[model samples]
Target: MARTKIIAGNWKMNKTVAEATSLVEELKKELATFEAAAVVLCPPFTALVSVARLLQSAPRIQLGAQNLHPAPSGAFTGEISAAMLREAGCRFVIVGHSERRRYFGETDAFLREKLLAAVAAGLRPIFCVGEELPDRESGRWPAHLRSQLQGALSGLSVDALSQIVLAYEPVWAIGTGRNATPEQAEEAHALLRKELEALHGATVASKMPIQYGGSVTPRNAGELLAQPDVDGLLVGGASLDAGSFTSIVFAVQ
Candidate 1:
């Protein structure tokens, strides 16, 4: 089966409720022309309810969460659970983003728990696996990513694994304005697919979509998506603006 292209916007730590609503409205209008790809918008937690309500009738564009806690409910202050996210109309949640790892001290073990929680809650988890610049420069990118993948996806059954959407986000490129070349993205994506195949078998791995998320923009979307192993993209800064994001969506379409 051919993997469906997913163009997801990571509005990380930006956009108020009103801003999110406006963005969603604009996306609904612009998305009408591009229905071939799955467009996901992940606004801040404060904006999920409003965004969800606004997109209640617009199913083409899905709502996602930037992060989620591993436990369903707990005294973990400042954290939201997977069930809570699902209730807010989120169909997906991003786990192990580099920012979280770098700033919040999230570890692979914690990410594994969160991935399981997201899966158990019936929410598709976009498991982010990537390497930092130093790791890449040291020729340890593959080993690092592979290790993270294994640890994060430790005990998931093949059936559970099938629901996962892997993202290959190079830490150095994210939010740095230094995007990876199409060839570079393709190489990483291909390697990621190979790793998945080793753990999940070709049949399941082939069906799983691997997305690139590192300074992706409309100008480069077409070339990036054209790569054989590049199934989709996890857009960041460019996705915050409706016009720019829609342009990227249409490019994929």
Candidate 2:
């Protein structure tokens, strides 16, 4: 079975409710022309409820959350639970983003817990896995990525694994005004698929969708999405603007 393409935007701490509403409205208008791929918008926690209300009747576009805590509920003062995200009309949740790992000290153990929570809440988990520049340069990319994949997804069943959407985002490329070369991105994507096959089976791995993230834009979207192993993209900066994000969406085909 072929994997469905998923073009998701990580709004990251940006956009107010009003700004999110306007952006979603414009995106809905532009997305009406393309129906082959799935589009998801992840707004900050502050805007999720409003954005969800705004897109109540929209069919093709979906809502996602940028982060979620592992526990369902607790004294975790600064964190939101997967259940809360679902309540806000979120169908997906991103776990273990590089920034979360770099800034908040999210370890593989913590990510695994969060992934389990997201799965239990019936939310599709888009697990972000990648290697830093120094690791890649030192030829430790494979080991590093393998460690993360193994550690984060060790206890998931084949069915649970199928629900995951893996994203290979190079730490150096994210928000650095630099994008990975098509060849580099394809290589990482392919490697990730192989790791999945080794951990799970060929059947599960073949159906799993692997996306490329990190400075993706309209200018490079087509070439990157055309790669055999690349199912879609986890767009960042380019996705903040409706016009550019829609253009990148069109570029997928």
Candidate 3:
């Protein structure tokens, strides 16, 4: 069975509410009848509600958040809960993005909690995992990726995993004008699928959707998506612009 492609744009730390609205309005116009892939736009936390409001009229497009707190609610100041995100009309939320892991020092144990929270709150999670340049060069990427995957997904049930989309964003490539080659992307994606099969089973792993990120653009999107195990894309900077983002969305066609 083929998985429906997903094109999720992670507008990290960019776009005020007004700018976000304009971008989505442009996206709505271009993707009015577009249904080639499931589309998700993740804006900054401050813009989620406003973006959600705009997305209400465009059901084809879905709203997502860049991050969320693992706890439902608490004294954890400066945190947004999954329940809050759901109430704001977010159908999806990104968890354990590389930046979060790097800048905020989020551990895999903590990411697992966030995944559980997101699912429990009825929001799908786009869980990210990847290795840095040194790891890749030292041939430690396999071990690093395995650790990240096992650490975060160890005890999760297959049912819970079903509600998640896995993303592979090479740390060195993100926002650096570098990206994995189709062959490299395929190798990594295939490994991830194999690992999933080991954790669950062939049936479950085969049905899961895995995405590639890191400096993706219209020029290279088509070739990247052509890889057998590469199911979708997790777009970043290019996604901030309506035209470029739309081009990347339709690149496969």
Candidate 4:
């Protein structure tokens, strides 16, 4: 089966409820005639319900969460669980974003727990795995990616793995406006496919979507989307703007 191209916006900490409504309304209108790729908006937790309601009629657009806790119910103050996210009307959830892994000291093992929780709770997870500048500079990023993938996704069965999406957002590139080159993204994506095949099998690996999430802009979106191994994108800053985000989606088509 061919993998569908997905463009998921990771709206981290931005957009008030009213602002989010306006944005999604605009997207619903602008993209109403658009039906090329799978689109998702990951607004802040406070905006999930509002955005989800707005996107209900837009079948091509899906609602996603930025982060969630591993447990179903717990006293983990300030932490949102997968169940809560589902209740908020989210069909997808981002797991192991670099910001969370770096700032919150989330280990690979910890992310594995989160991925498991998200999957078990019926929300599909866009599992992020990538490396920082130092790792890339030392030419050890591939090894790091291998270890990360093994630690986080290897234990899952093929059925669960098939329901997941993999995102490669080089740590040094996420918000710096310096995205990896098309060749670079392809190289990383191809490596991820290899890893997935080893962990599961060729059939599961072939259909898994590997998204590129860094400093993606409409200017470079076309080139990146053209990569055979780059199945989609996990857009950040640029996704906040309706025009720019729309342009990126069109780039896929």
Candidate 5:
């Protein structure tokens, strides 16, 4: 079976509800023109309800959330829950993103609970795992990635695992106008596959999608997509622009 290429745009902290709707309107006009990767738009939580309402008429595009709180409900302050996202029309939620880890100090333990919450709420989890510049420079990134993958997803059922879309975003590359070459990205993706095989079986591991996230633009999209192991892209900056994001999506062809 061919894995569906997922092009998830993490519109982190950008765009108001109105701006998001306008962008989605632009995307709706053009997204259907390309039979490219499955397109997911992740606006800030504030825009989800509005964006979700718009997406009802434009079914080609999917809605996702940048993040979610682990609990269904509680006194978690200003955090939103997976159930709330579900009601807001989110089909997917990103967990363990480098930004969350770096800025908020989210740990693997917390991410595991978030993943479980997402799965329970019938939302797919886009689990982000990656290394920082220091880890890569020390040549310990593979080990770092493995620990994140295993340590976070250790006891998930096969069903829950299937709902996951793993995104590898090297901290050094994200939003820095730099990216891992196709070869380097492929190597990391291949290593992730190996790690999955060890945790699950080869059959299960082979079917999972491993997406690369970083400074992915139309210029490098085609080459990166051409690499056999790179199943999709968790796009950032380029995705903020409808034209550029569409170009990157078409590069999958």
Candidate 6:
């Protein structure tokens, strides 16, 4: 089963509506005819509506949201719900990002509900899992990664699990200008695939796309994408500019 490459740009916290519109306008032109990989642009909540409108013309590129609350209609102030994101024209939503773990104190148990909500609302989740610098140094990254996958996905139905796209973003490397070598990225992605196989079955696991994130630049995107298990990228800073992001997309070969 050949999984299509999915290159998603997580424009976390940056990009006002105006800035997001400008960037997507450029991306629409550059990626208008690109069909090698699936491109997803995750803008901040504030820009979703505007970006969604802009993307109507660029049908190949999909719209995604940075995060979503589990509850459908919540009293949770400052939280966006899956239904809201869906109505905003988001086909995808990022779940369990490391920043949400570190800053907002999102737990795997909590994220499980988020996954349920996302799928129930017909939104595919870009579920992020990774280790911090200390965990990597202590050689506990494998166990840490396993814990994250199992903790959130243990009891999910095959239908639910099928809607997920996993992203391996080393906490230390994100936004630090340092990236994992292609070998290192492959090792982590392979481990994640193995874990998924155990939790689900080989057929289901093989169909799932596992993406690599963390300081991914156009210069390194090609080598990283060359890894067998590294299906795509969850780009950060490099995705801010349309030119650089387009270059990363064109690196599919």
List of clashing residue pairs for candidate 3: none
Candidate 5 achieves a global lDDT of 0.91
Q: What C-alpha lDDT do the candidate models reach, one value each?
A: 0.90, 0.91, 0.94, 0.93, 0.91, 0.95
What does candidate 3's lDDT look like per residue over 16-47, in tens digits? 98999999999999999888899999999999
lDDT at residue 235 of model 6 (Cα atoms): 99
On residues 1-253, what C-alpha lDDT tens digit does candidate 4 reach at each position?
4689999999999999999999999999989988778898999999999998888899889999999999889799999999999998999999999999989999999998998898888999999999999999999999999999998986887768878999999999988988899999999999999988888889988999999999999999999999999999999999999999999999988
Q: Give me the displacement of residue 157 in model 5, in angstroms.
A: 0.6
Task: State the lDDT of candidate 6 residue by residue for 83-122, as single tens digits.
Answer: 9999999999999999999999999999999999999999
Q: Is candidate 2 or candidate 6 better by TM-score?
A: 6
Q: What clash pairs does model 4 have?
A: none
Write the residue-wise lDDT of candidate 5 on 121-193 in tens digits. Answer: 9999999999999999999999999999888989888999999999989999999998999999999999998
Question: How does each model score on TM-score?
Answer: 0.97, 0.98, 0.99, 0.98, 0.98, 0.99
lDDT of 2 by residue, 1-253 (tens): 5789999999999999899999998988888767888889999999999889877767888999999998889999998998999999999999999999999999999999999899999999999999999998999998999999999988789878878999999998999978899999999988988888898889877998999999998999999998989999999989999989999999878
Error of 1 at 218 (Å): 1.1
How displaced is residue 14 in candidate 2, in Å? 0.3
Error of 2 at 63 (Å): 0.3
Off by over 4 Å in 5: none
Candidate 5 clashing pairs, residues 3+ apart or interchain: none
